[model samples]
Target chain A: MKISILRKKLDDKEISAVELTRLYLDRISAADKLTDAYLYVNYDGAIKAAQSAQTIIDAKQSRPFTGIPIALKDNLCTFDMPTTCSSKMLDGFVPPYDATVVAKLRGQGAVFLGKLNMDEFAMGASTKTSYYKKTKNPYDLTRVPGGSSGGSAAAVSVGLCAAALGSDTGGSIRQPASFCGITGHRPTYGFVSRSGCIAFASSLDQIGPLADTADDCAALLTATAGRDIYDQTTADKTFDLKKSDKGIKGKRFGLIKELMGKEVDKDVSAAVKKAAEWFINAGAVVEEVSLPMLTHAVPIYYLISSAEAASNLAKFDGVRYGFRPEKTLNFFDMISKSRDEGFGWEVKRRIMLGSYALCSGYYDDYYKRAIKLCGIIKSQYAEAFKKYDALLSPVAPTTAYPFDKLPDDPAQMYLADICTVSAALAGLPSLSTPCGYDKDGMPIGLMITGKRFDDAAVLSAAGAYEKEFVRKPPQLKGVSEMKL
Target chain B: MKSDISIKWLGNLSKIKFDDDGLKKMAADMQSIMTLMDSLLLVEPVEFEDGTEFCGLDALRADTVRDSFDPELLVSQAKDSKDGCFVIPKIL
Candidate 1:
């Protein structure tokens, strides 16, 4: 159900927040076993929060997200719940404070459905690397839902919740949203505060929303965005996200040539092409634009992201908090054993590579070069945006891949990020909406990226395209559907 | 194009032991990947000084009496703790 419709239903007494919360919880109980979408469901706390929202609704205190059920990706800190990033390293770590986004959502009376699963420490493209079980795509059980925000996307797609909050660092949100056939928005980096979110690649990370539709994402962004003193990087500008009938008329859009090449899956390219035709038919000018620098994005992203991840993850030693080693011969042995026992294989791999990249002899050669490449990628987007209002691309190279068929080779796995990394490096607002389905019935997403702090424009373009071109995926049989 | 940096050096720095064969495979893979990255040298260099800025971290004025975390929560997960501190074996 859409948040706006849900709000009207609540206002008319057609539904109570308590009833809505219970309904979602019941749906979660039935569906989550199949999808593995949640790492931890806060049954009691969620009910209590819902009851509080009910009181607010009774008092006639209506807010944008009031009485709406929302799922939080496990990486976002929650003061009242365990904020595990689906890793044993933080298995029982209850943050002393809520993340800024969480605080704002709660203040708006958005019911917390539960904490969803993710790649361990947001490190992998697939949630298979999670210490918990992998999240299965709701559309097809054998296929991956994509990650590290896999669970968030899956939950919203399957109607476990109306919407969800996801962290996008290198396609975590957009990739999963594409795979799950839902709407996900990665706002310009720092548009939403990151205070209290566990740091991964601090510079690259941005909190975003994953919802069933573009308008829902826009509403969630309004509630979750803006500057916070605690998070100095957040933008000071306001994003007014009311439903605008502004069609993409006369706007110039660039179809990134690098993203549309022969390397992309044939079906995926066809779907995006169909969406481009829709844009052109809507009286907008669509032209193919070159961003050759995007070719270097993945490698540079890995270098910088892994280097920062190594430092951010160092704090999880057994001494202060998190998991501890059962036995150790020395202090150094204790720290080493603690980390070795705590982190999963993917996490360990990143930490090792990150440490290597940031090591004394290699710092200037690897980390420094990667930082420079990031600048080039950013400039490429800036130069492109100077001529175009937004850039259109495929969210991923292909639609959702079958769970068992994922490449065992890490490099091949990294290649899945081919089209999405440039926007991440440039810190631009980008979104993925389900454009069309492939022959295999997998959904293809058309990614829309705008200049920095241009979130409203990006979302407006996506909303317009959604209205003109996209068709909602037919509800899968045997999944009990909920009515607003 | 891929070079095999000695495994002994990697093993020493990472504090993980690898057999000669394991070292050879890892080195070969890393070298291949690094060789790919070496292609960046040919691309025109971006003027780094223009847009680069340090983020997240800030040098704020120190607070001497800031609120500290509960000492009990700190050692709550430790396998061994005593008298407000976690006990560790000798390092030196």
Candidate 2:
């Protein structure tokens, strides 16, 4: 059920918070092995929170999220539950405090559905890079749920949870949501605070929501967004939860030319074209928008994200916190061996590339150039915004590739985010709304990106499309099949 | 082209030791990524705009006395700690 309907049910006392929490927990226990959606299940803590929510409900004083259960991406710090980032580097490390988003959600009396799995430190396009279990696509168990927010989207897809929060840097949330056939929203950068979430690439990373619908995503974004004194990057502007649909009447949307190349899968391109046609039918102008600088987005994003990651990850040297090698050695040697063992191959690869980029003699040639290219990329998006209210694209080139179809080279996998990175580079509000299915029946997501800090407009615009064109995915199996 | 020697230097800088096979894979991967990165060479010079006043570095809070995590809680995350200090290997 959607968040509003579920809230109404709780308000009417049709079901208690305890009963709802138990239902979700039971579903998670049943299918978590197949989906690998959760890294840790906070059953005891969820029950406690539900009981507290029930007290508030009985007294007739309840918030919008009072009895709601949310699956949080494991990267966010939670005082009680483990925030592993699905990496062995910080295995079993629980923070002393909650991330600002966690604190805000707790204040709303939201029940914890435990820490969901993600790419180790939110690094890759696929959960194959996770140090823990590989999450499977709910649409097809043989395929991967896209990462780094694979489990978060998959959980919401299969109805393991009502909504989930995931961090997106270069399309983690949107990519996974596309694969899993759910709605995921990456809000304007700096609109949502990032304090206490484990850092991957500081400037690029923004925590976002994955849910069953656009309105659910908007509600979750409302709960987590707003200013935080702890994270100075946050804007003080409040998120307007009230959605207004102008419909596609007089709405001008650009079909990003670069994103709809022949390289994109046939059915994926067809879905994007169909979305454009729907807008045209609604009396809106649709034009092919060219942003030549988008080609550079992938490389620039990789360089910048990895460079930031190297510096951010330097803290995990085994002395301060988390997993440490038991072998006796000097301080430096201990740190070296611990990291070598602790981090996965992908993490180590990025760290090395980042180190090389920032190292002497190559700093200007690599890191600085990448930053300059990022500025150019942003300028292209800014120019496009002058003509269009929003831009459209397929979330990825194709739907979820089979799990066994692993690429040996890391660069081969980086190609997956080709369509989704440009918006992230510009700090825009981007979302993936499931539009249609591919020939293989895998879901295709229509990506909509609006101006920076125009999150409400972006969300409502996409939500309007859902109302107009009811292109729903096939019925999911497992828990989602269970009639709630 | 990414040199094997330079990558070895990079591994040293990153403080992660690689076996011979690991070194080969890292070198090949870095080389491929760098080749892909050449696409950025076409873009002209550009400036990184500092964000708005409320969201930039200048908006950071003033340095002042503030509450921090309890020392016990801070040390609790350390795998080995004693007497308010993390226990690392010998330095001197």
Candidate 3:
């Protein structure tokens, strides 16, 4: 259900938070068998939290997101559950504190359903790398729901939960949300506090929400997006929920010339072009712009993110926090054995590449040059932003593909992120809204991006475009409007 | 593929141990990924200073002591601990 409509229902006492929580929990239980979306279901904790939300609602103290059941991506630290990052290294490890986003959402009375699966340590483009079961797209069971926020997207798309929180680093959230046909937002870097979030790539990672509509993501950000003293990198400006008309008139949108090329599936490209055309018809100027450096986004992203990840993941050495081997002949042996047994193949591979990139002889050649190229890519987007109010593109080159059709090489999967990474590298705000379906009956995503710190405007433009998007997947079309 | 010695050295530096097959597979994977990254060198070089300054950092907070987590709380999370300290095998 949409948060705004549900808020009124909750406040009027037509439905208690406890009842709403039960409905979502039941849905998750029914959906889990098919989607493998949730890694852990915190039934007892959710019930207790819902009862508290009920008390707040009865007293007429409810907030925008109060009483809503929201699923958390496994990477967010929660004192009530294990924050595994879908990797065995942290299996069964419960954090003593909540992540900044969790702390904020809890203050607003949001119900926690459970933790959702993701790429192990948020490394891969597909949830196939998750330590738990792989999540499949709800539309077609044979195809993948993109990752590493695959579970978050799938759960939200299928109504397993009212909404969900997912982290984006190099398209983890947006790509999956596109594949699952839900709304996903990636706040500009530093806009959302990252404290207590298990770091994959500290510089690039930002947590946001995936839900039924752009307004819902905006509301989620209003509650959770802001600075935290704990995370020095958080931006100084907090997200304000002042309601604007969010009209599309008089805005200029850019369609990157490089992004519309042959790599994109014709269906996917056409759907985005149709969205651009909609803006044009709505009294907005639509122009084709150039960002040639975007072609280098994938390679540079790997170098920088991997380098940071290698350093960030070093803390999981079995000495403190997470899993540890039972036997060891020496201290070094203990750390080595724990990591070897605990991490999955993808996690280990990333650590290997990161170590190589940051190593003594290779540091300047690979890591340093990539950082320089990343700067050029950032300016390239910035240069376009100077001429355009917002930008548009396909979230990925194609819709969800069948698992058997995916390439054997990991690099091929990395290449799939070609369209989404440049925005991340540039630290710009971006989102993916379901535009239309392909001939194969899979959903295609239309991505909208704006300048750094121009997040609210970005969301407003998407919310304006979302009017025509009320046409949802056949299964989910009327689910949000269904009376409890 | 990376040289056998270099691959072994990287594993050691990263504190990871892989079997011979895992090592060979990882080396091959890294070689292919590196080949893709090689294209970045041809992009026109630009200036960028290496630092966290690009990310907006909040001004430093007051230095006054405040309520803090007990050391034992962190130690309790360790896989093995005793007497408020993490227990590990002897290095020597």
TM-score of every prediction relative to native: 0.93, 0.97, 0.96
From the highest lDDT down, the ranking of the candidates is 3, 2, 1
DockQ of candidate 2 compared with the true complex: 0.61
lDDT of 2 by residue, A297-355 (tens): 88888889899999999999988897788884788888888888999988998898788
Clashing pairs in 3: none
Model 2 TM: 0.97
Measured against the true two-chain complex, the DockQ scores of the candidates, in the order shown, are: 0.34, 0.61, 0.59
lDDT of 3 at A306: 91
lDDT for each residue of candidate 1 in B11-92, tens digit (9 for 90 to 100):
4455443456755666655655555556655666657544533333463435566677787765765656887798767768
* Residue-wise C-alpha lDDT for candidate 3, range A38-72, written one tens digit per residue: 99998999999999999998888888878889999
Candidates' RMSD to native = 2.7, 1.8, 2.2
Which 10-residue window of candidate 1 chain A scores lowest in summed lDDT?
A: A469-478
Which residue runs of candidate 1 sit more than 4 Å off their true CA positions?
A243-246, A470-477, B1-36, B42-87
Instruction: For candidate 1, write residues A1-484 as lDDT tens digits.
Output: 7888998998788988889889999989887888999988988888898889888889999798888999999999998888989989888888877999999999988899889999999988779889979899887888899999999999998899989999999999999999999999999887799988888998889999999888999898889888687777776656776643365889999999999888899999988998999999888999999988898787788888888988888787777678876767877767766776788767765665676778776777778888877887877787888899999999999888898898866666776798888888888889999998888788889999998877877898888877766555535456777876
Model 1: pairs clashing at backbone N, Cα or C within 3 Å = none
